[model samples]
Target: MLDLVAVLLALGLLMYLAYRGVTLLILAPAMALLAALLTGGLPILGAYTQIFMTNTGAFIVSFFPLFMLGAIFGKLMDDTGSAKSLAGSVSAWLGPERAIVSVVLCCAVLTYGGVSAFVVAFAIIPVAAALFRAADIPKRLMPGALALGAFTFTMSALPGSPAIQNAIPMPFLGTTAFAAPGLGIITGLVMLLLGLAWLNRRAARARAAGEGYGAHADGVPGPDVAMREHAQGEGFDIAELSGDPAPGKPHRDGNLPPVALAVLPVVVVIVTNFAFIRIVIPMLDTAWLAEPLFGATTIESVRGVWAVIVALFFAILLLIAGNWRRLADLRASLDKGADASVLPIFNTASLVGFGAVIAALPVFDLISETVLGVGGGNPLMSVAVSVSVLSAMTGSASGGMSIALDSLGPTFVDLAHATGVSLDAMHRVTAVASGALDALPHNGAVITLLTVCKITHREAYGDIFIVACAIPMLALAVLIVLTNLLGSF
Candidate 1:
């Protein structure tokens, strides 16, 4: 039908425009209006103002705290030299021979502790650059190293990860961050090991080709050269690189905070988050949450969100307390973090609005029905494929996951129940799938990583595609097979 054609066209337009570097702020609403107008009976302005804004506003309301707090926490880490100090210690401990693993672990630790991926890239890149240069690793491999750590296991498959990808599925599937604990642990390890192997292999081949960290084609010094220049007070500054001048200059080991002190805040986040989810929130008598004003919510619906928020709050205070004397301007850092959150939240919310409008069209009903019917009654594969395709289309994990679950979550839940599937399995699978295709060339995270590392897609995207996308997809398939055979865990 023409309605279906219009829906397809809108999706195609969204992907194309986004890939061409158009901001989603414009493309989401424009593509949404196109879909609405082509459907032939809706008031275009009403759809934009009413349906679109409502869904967008709802997403922002639900997640603003996490976004804002996480950004602020990451900014504090960057500003205080905590992030760089941790990176430096890890690099020294791992030695130049194990540079790839060192970089990957640094990124994994930060992200698993709830730092935003965008912020992780910015915070870690200079360190990654320095390590790769020291190890004589190809500069092009930096993105892969960073992506492997930040974009893989810790971001999606790890149980108790504070990543938004993991959090988004909690309310929808009525599951917790620790959903499918056995499966998540297994998948996380698989991704970590396999992705590391791939990157190491690539590094070996690049070494065989005698390719060292090449000079930046744009005249920026390679990491080693830059560090040498800094030694002579003529190089790119760390303060400038991180956009915070608190850590005025690189310090000798004696001048830096102790490694344990540098790492304590991250540990606090993970530990506090776990305690809240496993103990604190459950013990509280929150019967009042069932009131109408609270939408008659259950503990399962809000436990994960509450845990992460409290954990972030605790971590923020800890980070500040640990680095108070080193801070440049506390107010400026807070303002910068708060300001930084606006674009990402709005970008995703815009897509949510676009999806809301698309869902209002009659054609979306047909589309949802078709997607829900995939895999011949296996809701696992059905949800996987549906979520993957939509994520690829939206070029955003959070955005695509929000749209798919908002429109089809109930249907997927019903299908899982009918098929005797565990909601935990569904939640885990949906969360992992969202991260898979969502790493396509156009993905916001991928773009940001590439931009931060200053590498072209031609040089770095292949490795990212393999480690972040292809490998995650493979892990998803393996998870599906294992769950189907062993029954949900």
Candidate 2:
């Protein structure tokens, strides 16, 4: 009982620290270590080893490079006005009356292609700025809709969302890729329709209400940083990235040849990912390979790290030219780009580590014992519902999942061993459950987007909460029912 209290206290402390804006990477692990000390784990040595190994592992960090790869592509798209061109091309097809729907579609597709919401936001916002401007829509309204487009279904309920926050739970749950694919696809399509419908209606309502209809229309959209509300700090020099503050000058009816600008980074990242999988992964399959390095890592982990480094290199080139103007201007631009990504990365990393500590220690184990005692007959439902409720309370998908997964992941593995369920299914349930609950008003990602986009928590969040919570909760119930019904077959 005391162990359970210690664990919950640790989780609560970490969550509170995150809320207070402490460095998550630093604080979360600290909370975990503190918890371990209270619980009397394998040893202080074991806890330290676990924290370092998990937090700093190459596989753990491969996503950082992936992010760099994605961010560079987004940054280029933002700067070159290419994203607007893409948005423009799509809007041209979808028609003005349906422009908002089109933007949502674009966001959904790009995000489903494995982009994070932050990357999607940076990439989409500028283009949305252009598309909305052309359609006479307000920029403030665009962020909410755009965030929904990228996040709502494709991220929360859909298949193959590359969100590590979502994907990491799969192995823990005992589900298969094939198990939930059909349901996930249907959910995405249904969600896409619902989102578009809601957004279109909102656009119409705003238009009819005539509140700030034409107010603060002071910007041109596209990669024109000179035209943006530049954030303070040493970030990128907008002048170099923006290439002259003049939104005019008819620079030409054309920019970089579309092929080079449009596809370079994407192609580069794909090649790197494939190359590492095929060429590098097999090379590490030997006994001697372990000793050649510092013995701290296997070639596999190093390969992952190297791949990220290469991706970032290509990314820097994709964003900046080799000329004097770009160099003189890069310091500020690079700094700014780094700034956009740094805090979020650090925050995510810290939270993940803290989550690891909580899990690796007995805190999670203590919770599981308690839940199992109370779960009674329908353990699966109990697990899902309890996780969902806790996540919603905290307004964090990953954080809540971390707490739940750490506690129950091993137990679920044991259950799968006994019941013949797949870990992948369990992972899916945990992930879906986390994102669903995270629809709460205070979830950092939701709150951040709302704050940055200048929307009230009141205006849009309630609708989002309904979508996040209702759809997935019901979906999970239906899945369980069908699973049982079909198991008879």
The number of the candidate with the highest TM-score is: 1
Q: Compute the lDDT of residue 332 as modeled in candidate 1.
A: 74
Candidate 2 segments exceeding 4 Å error:
1-13, 33-82, 129-141, 170-179, 201-214, 217-346, 360-363, 370-396, 399-403, 468-489
Query: In candidate 1, which residue ranges exceed 4 Å CA deviation?
Result: 217-255
lDDT of each: 0.81, 0.54
Among the numbered candidates, top lDDT falls to 1
> Which residue pairs does candidate 1 place in steric collision?
none
Model 1 superposed RMSD (Cα): 4.9
What C-alpha lDDT does candidate 2 achieve relative to the native structure?
A: 0.54
lDDT of 1 by residue, 280-329 (tens): 98689989889999899988888888888998899999877877767657
Question: For each candidate, what TM-score against the reference?
Answer: 0.92, 0.68
